[model samples]
Target: MVTAIIMLSVEKKHINQVAEKLASIKGLSEVYSVSGPYDIAAIARVQNNDEISELVTQHLAQIDYILKTETMLAFKAYSKDDLEGMFSVGA
Candidate 1:
């Protein structure tokens, strides 16, 4: 799975609206209204890199409330399975 974090910069007045709209998209997992240079942050898991482009262009960019966005792709993840295996003393 390809995991991506999309940081959205929205107009102050449109923060909630933008977050709500983001929630409607299929791949988007979570959306948070944040306090920082960006107004909102979201996490998504996609099937491939191409879908990222489609998500950014076709979905996100079309939202009037979203002014800009920054995306970070994760190459690896630390899951509960990883932790469990690491801490296990014996089989």
Candidate 2:
């Protein structure tokens, strides 16, 4: 799966509403109200790079209240589960 971290800058009054709407998008897996230069961070997982484009263009672009968005493509995944398995090898 291809995973994207989408950072959003939304109109101050529409942050919560936009977060709720974003959570419902087909490929988006998680939505968060965060503190930073961006107001929201959303995680989207899909089948390929093209799906990422579709999610941004077809789905996200339709939200009128979103002021700006920055999408980052993940090249690798590392987690606690992966670390445990790797350290246990031949032990």
Candidate 3:
């Protein structure tokens, strides 16, 4: 699987609209409304790199309220679930 973190700068009034739209997209796993330089952060997981490109270029880029975006590809993932399983001393 391929994963990407997308930071979005959305039109102030349309933040919720944009976030809701993002949540309904096929590859997007999570969407968060955040404060900072960017208005939202989205997590995308797909089968391959080409899917990521299509998701960003075809789907995400077409949203009218999203003014700008920055995408970061994930090289590795470490989650609490994985850590807990690895370090468990007993059942």
Compose the digit string of candidate 3's lDDT tens values, residues 1-91.
7889999999999999999999999988789999899999999978799999999999988899899999999998877576334333343
Between prediction 1 and prediction 2, the one with superior TM-score is 2
List runs of model 3 lying over 4 Å from the truth. Answer: 83-91
- Cα distance off (Å), candidate 2, residue 54: 0.4
User: Model 1: which ten-residue window has the lowest total lDDT?
Assistant: 82-91
lDDT against the true structure, per candidate, is 0.84, 0.89, 0.89
Expressed as tens digits, the lDDT of each residue in 1-91 for candidate 1 is 5779999999898888889999999888789988889889998777789998899889998899788899999888777576334333353
lDDT of 2 by residue, 60-91 (tens): 99997999999999888877566335434555
Where does candidate 2 stray beyond 4 Å?
82-91
RMSD of 1: 6.4
Clashing pairs in 1: none
TM-score of decoy 1: 0.83
